[model samples]
Target: MIRSPRGVEDILPSQVSQYQWIEKEASSLFSLYGYEEVRTPIFERAELFLRSLGEETDAGKQMYIFQDKKGRRLALRPEATAPVVRAYLQHNLYGKTREWRVYYLGSMFRYERPQAGRYREFRQIGIEAIGEGSPYLDVEIIEMAHQFFKRVGLDKVELQLNSIGCRKCRPFYEEKLKEYLKKNMDRLCPTCQRRYQYNVLRVLDCKNENCQLVIREAPWIGEYLCEDCSSHFQSVKEGLKALGIKFQINPHLVRGLDYYTRTIFEIISPVLGAQNAICSGGRYDDLIEELGGPSVPAMGFAMGVERVLLALREEKKGIPYKRLPLIYIATLGREGWRAGYELANLLRLKEIRVQLNTSKRKLSSQLSFAAKRGIRWVMILGEEEVKKRRVILRDMNSGTQKELEWEKLEENIEEIKS
Candidate 1:
């Protein structure tokens, strides 16, 4: 049989509850902050990413691009912010309200060299607040992310913060960076050398060890930020400080995307080693206008769902393993099978979880199957018991058994559940 494609894997039944719990936590927390949920198409017109991520950036290049029968280019969305902005503009949301707050949870596709916590098909939990430009909004977005990690019992992460300045000052810093990178051109990685010429700021986001060393001595954007951008950065810092959230300033932390401005940050889990940024986002003040909407200033962030899950596992601080309350109904004969069916339905109608055995196996074999499945309760019905309208209820955990009247068991559903 054919296997799952490389760089992609299934979220099997054993792992679904954890995803569901994370989903519920995210939905509740975002709603508490006045953010509503929005879902866009998985694939969008290919041009959207080119405009948002810039044609030379890694995200734009990694797009899984294809064409419809009519030859219109489309691609799976590599991130949610671009499509969310598209939705905002397409719906003319800016005209209706000055600010639109929305959150999204979904899969994104990127053709990448897959590794731990990174996949070709991945999921992200993100929020976009469009039309507000205050530095305080930046603080709130960052704080919300911090609170989310804490809420999920992940305390082993650190927040690394920075300001890449806006369009006004970024050029000055980029020029200085290019000048410095040229001095170390021979030492820099081949990819960084190319990036230095084409998309200069992305060179800072390079993961190559040699590149990182070169970047350490390069010009820091903070020293070159224009007065306006500097003030904005200060205000963001003050707001975060006032809220008692701790952060470390990372001078070389320019995010990989092209559209970020003024402020950017990443939440890193040391447990994940070098590729440890579990969450990242920042302000994109001009992206909406860049994509054909009114000049709107928005800020948002995205948490890599798989990365966060990995961090949780490494630290052993995730949702506890839980088996849903289940009573396995094992049948011994045809009549027992028919009665088991009725009992399962009645119990289900009472909002109880149940699994009725289909295997026509012996009683001992059935009990062994239930034990291996970790099902605590088992209702065994055989020919003799079915005739008397009574069934044996066995507690698999304690290896205890008792006979329960069929009608009594149905009336007192709590007994089976307890």
Candidate 2:
């Protein structure tokens, strides 16, 4: 038998209810923030990720790259923000509104070692607010994310916040950080040593124990932020405080993206050990212009649906599944099967959840199958019932039965279930 590729999971029927619940709750919550949904392709030109995520980032390194028949390079999207920005420019959405608010839910592909909440193929629910630069908007987005976690039944989630500084002062901070790293070069990890030459700030995000030790005393970006960035950061904190959204300022909290600027944050849950971040994003004030669009400030975040589900499981939270069929039609001969099929469609037209048994099984076997599946109501259609133009509806829960005329079945559907 052929097997699925490693690190990808099949969302089987037994487990799909949880994902459905998450999607529904996400749509509802996003709508409350005036964020309409947008969808982009699953793949795009490889240059998009390389340019947006940067050459040294893990997404650019781990993306699934391939060539089409025409030899054009393309990659399965490893994240959604770049694609969303591309769509915004391609459609000239910025022309309509000063701030375009949109959300997306889809699968993202990456090549990585599979672990507890991480997968090679994963799902992300994200929202983007483009064309706005106000610190109030920043606080609003953070509060919206917090509200989403609450609606999803998550608790003990820490909002780790930071300001990576913008281009104005980041150059100075980089020089200082490079100097620090150089003085402690021997204590740095080999990866940090290599990254120091290309992306020095990444060393602060390094997970290596020794590199972390070296990073502890490194100059903080907050100290070097220009006057504009400093004021904006302070205003964002004040706004968060006004809204009662608790956050911790982590100087080392540089998110894993090249586009982020000014403000960055990660929502970490203790339920996911080691890989604790369930959602992360930040302000990318220059990304829109970098992508060839007009200068537009944008900020958005993506939540790992798999990690959220894992957190929910660890919390033992109960997510209600979609309602099951209220009635099942079990037919006995060819004539009964024909009548049952017709009745099933009629009931369905009236918005009733009915399951029609299509098997050529005996009446007793059909009823047994329905019972085993926990179906509450079973409508029996046999030769006698077909001739009489009526159905015998049995209540599985109460072991009660009632006969109803064909013409009255639609009108009595509610009463029959009760």
lDDT of 1 by residue, 1-418 (tens): 9999999999986677788788888889999999999999999999999889988888989999999999999999999999999999999898899799999999999999999999999999999999999998999999999999988999989999999988888888889888888889999898888898778988887888998888878878889999999999999999999999999999878888999998899999999987899999999999999999888999999999999889999998857545565899999888999999999998889888889999988989988988898888999999999999998988887899899898788554676555
Q: How far is candidate 1 from the true structure (C-alpha RMSD, Å)?
A: 1.9
By TM-score, the best candidate is 1
**Tens digit per residue, CA lDDT, model 2, 1-418:** 9999999999986578788889889989999999999999999999998999998887779999999999999999999999999999989988887578999999999999998889999999999999899899889999999999999889879999999999889999999999888899999998889888878888999999988888889999999999999999999999999999999999999887889999899999987899999999899999999999999999999999999998888888887784578789999889999999999999889788889999999888998988988888999999999999989989888888999899987667878555
Candidate 1 TM-score versus the reference: 0.95
**Clashing pairs in model 1?**
none
**Superposed model 2: Cα runs more than 4 Å off:** 397-418
Q: Please provide TM-scores, in order, for all candidate models, with all chains considered together.
A: 0.95, 0.93
lDDT scores in order = 0.90, 0.91
What lDDT would candidate 2 get against the real structure? 0.91
List runs of model 1 lying over 4 Å from the truth.
321-325, 406-418
